[model samples]
Target: MAFLGVALLGLLAGAAVMYVLYRPRFEELRRQAEAEAQRLRESAQAQSRELLVQAQAEALRVRNEAEADIKQARQALLKQEERIQQLEERLARSQEKVDRKLDDLERRERGISQRERQIERLHREAEELKHSQQAELERIAGLTTDEAREIVLKRVEATARDDAARLMRQIEQEAKDEAEKRAKKIISIAIQRLASEYVAELTVTTVPLPSEELKGRIIGREGRNIRAFEQITGVDIIVDDTPEAVTLSCHDPVRREVARLALTKLLKDGRIHPARIEEVVEKTRQEIETIMREEGERVVYEAGVQGLHPDLIRILGRLKYRTSYGQNVLQHSLECALLAGAMASELGANVQVAKTAALLHDIGKAVDHEVQGPHALIGADIARRLGRSPAIVHAIAAHHFEEEPQTVEAFIVAAADAMSGGRPGARRETLDLYIKRLEALETVATSFPGVQRAFAIQAGREVRVMVQPDAVDDLGSITLARNISRKIEESLQYPGQIRVTVIRETRAVDYAR
Candidate 1:
């Protein structure tokens, strides 16, 4: 600190001395500063000149390298251009060759088409030549060509007929040889499955009384009730000396049902007058109609038939109350259907067709009184009207053979109808009368040329004839039966139907004792 103080003192003293001595030294210091700035500028200029020289050399080297790469790239591009030019020339030549080939192919296609037409013409001419030759051959055969053709056809037909006859003969012989055993078995099968109780003429129907006095009431005031009842029911109300009961009667079922029900109500109300009787009958009529509709539908359903007319259905219902001979018609129809099915099964026929035909065979009986014609024919007409098939109509008409048996099914139906009515208990006859009848049948049958022993069965519905093996040939039975039948028809008056059976036996045996 003292040294700084002494220096400051000396500087003050020296400044006083310099201010007096070196006032002229300021110009010399300015000249020295100018000289140092000039030297720095000269050095900086020399460094810039060296940098410029190096940059120019580097730029020249880079330009030479770029020129060399450009020259190499130019050479490669020229080579690629030359190769593309060669490919273009080849493509032009190939296109020219393809155009020439296409022209040649078109010319060949035209020539081939012309040849195909020529071949077709040749084929047509060949076919015509062949046909002409055939015509010439046919003309040379005989008479005219048409006549020769007829002769050839006739020969073919004759040969066919002869072959068919031989076949039929063989079949007939074989069938006859097996007929007896097969017949027995088939008959047994038919009988075994048929279950029907015996039936008799049912002339009496019982109507229970409301009370003991109801019987008197049915007699009515002045017997008007009885008269009205009989007239309406078409039946004889036999109010006899019996107690609490009356016999209802009518041949027609609808009439009988009407009478029975009417009497029942009348007896219950204890009102015995014509007015009351009429009113009750009208009510009974409605009830019966309902029952009739239901019954008719049931019959059609069970018969497995459809599309029956309503009117026909009503008629069918009446059969429910109707009886033929003694068997109920409805029940008889079902029995017939069953028998027809069995027979059809045995015969290899349409069982449903047989059954339906048989069931409908007697449908006409329901309205026979109001219609005209044989029952079978009438039934056939009705069935046809109801849109049944022609086959069905034919079957129904021919069931009784009233019409010719056009089909095996028709004969089956007839057989079924007979089976239903003629079985024992299915119809009524006294034992003595039945026996006498059978005896007469046998007598008449035995009177035929090929004399035979006869036995009546099924209460004379059927007759069995065992002929002498020598007297009757295979066909003689049919002829003899026809003869017997003609005689029976003339000599005997029978009901329903009768079946004729001819039996022939041949046996080879040795007796041993």
Candidate 2:
């Protein structure tokens, strides 16, 4: 038993030694673990504090940006509000101007109404005064107002009639003066522009003999040759007293021309027998016909006329043998055509129509003996039958006043005819005939009631009549001149135109005291 006790006590001592060594080491390890946990907790708290501070700073920056944005928006709204206020002010001023214009219009309307009432009142007063004055005048004059008005109107009408008549006379005088001046200028220019030779052709043909003795041979042994010659040629062979000249006289110019040619040939050949005479005369007639045609064509060409009928040309050729008032009809016709054409150019008329009409104006004289009408009318008919235009035909007919000249061409033709016939030395008149024409002109002029003396001047182209001033007034003198002109036209058959002039003289004589 004693050995077991000692062994247990030794085991207990070893256990106590092990407990003291392990307890201090265990306390130290637990303190180290607690301190490491506290350090980890402090690190986590500091990190969280820094995160919170950063978040607050970020929130402050965001709020400042929002405030700045709100300030800009407010500034824009304020500027817009100012603009609206200005617009309102402008609208208010415009309304004020409109109100002023309306007020002015209303005032003008009121003033116009007042003026209209005043005018009505004044008009009534004026009408009353006029009626009172008219009544007083009627009472003083012892005549009705209508009677006074009629008297005044009659006087005024009489004065107006006198004034109208004077004005009409003055206008007539001025117009006549202007027309006369223009006519004179046109005629003078036309005459000055054209210079045509005036040849006075005789109807009678004269033949020159080599000797006076040849005349007896032409008479041919006891008048038998003469009679045969006359019978064959249809012309009178006059053995006149003239030296070395034999006269062939015939109304038919063609026959006269033929006789002239035959006589010439007979004298030249010295063969005066009847058979030779008939043969020579027949040959001469043929030659003359040929000459007539050639002459017709020559004139037509010279005058620049075309498209004439063959028959018409031949008839125109016959005019070469015809004479009018001692003027060759063909020459006169040519002159008329040239003058008419010149005048037509100057006056802006159809030159061809004028020339053609004027050239054919005397064509009727060719066959007047055969026809039963005036030469103008006959010529017109011939031209119409030849397919001439109406203007041409009318011009031909009216050249001699047979028909009233309708166109300017007709008047031109008439004027050309006058110019051709009226030129100096163009025609010859017997002294007896000329004297008779002058006397007839004077007689016609003096036949008027108030004519003191009448004088035929300008070779019967003009008549000057002197009128008594007391008997024929200025107006009366005009009437007398016209009447005298009409009488002369009716009585006289002279060539060209005649002018009538009437003169009235008013004399005032006074002696100085």
Best by TM-score: 2
lDDT for residue 458 in candidate 2, whole number 0-100: 92
Misplaced by over 4 Å in model 1 are: 1-177, 180-215, 231-234, 239-249, 345-348, 430-436, 439-443, 446-458, 461-513
Off by over 4 Å in 2: 1-169, 181-193, 240-244, 486-496, 506-513
State model 1's lDDT: 0.79
User: What range of 10 consecutive residues in model 1 has the weakest lDDT sum?
Assistant: 195-204
Candidates' TM-scores?
Answer: 0.53, 0.65
Query: Candidate 2, overall lDDT?
Result: 0.89
Put down candidate 2 lDDT per residue, 1-513, tens digits, no spaces: 888999999889988888887989989999999999999999999999999999999999999999999999999999999999999999999999999999999999999999999999999999999999998988999989889989999999978766776787688789989988987877777777667556678765888889989988888888889999999988998898999998888878888889988888888899898999999999999999999999999889877888999888999999998988789999888888888888888789999999999999999999997889999999999999998999999999999888999999999999889878887788888899899989988988898788899999999889999999999877666667767878877777777778888988888999999
Q: How far is 157's C-alpha from truth in model 2 (Å)?
A: 9.7
lDDT of each: 0.79, 0.89
- lDDT by residue (1-513, candidate 1, tens digit) is 999999999999998998878767977888888998899899999999999999999999999999999999999999999999999999999999999999999999999999999999999999999889878887786466678788999999978766766676578669867986886676568767775454544533788775677777777778887888777667898878877788886656677778887877776677678777778888998998889788878867876666667877886777777777677887787677777777788989987788778778888988787788898999999989987778889999988667889898898887778767766567666678777888899898888866658888876778888999898866666666767778898788575567788888988999899
Q: Determine the backbone clash count of candidate 2.
A: 0
- Model 1: residue 403 alpha-carbon error in angstroms: 0.6
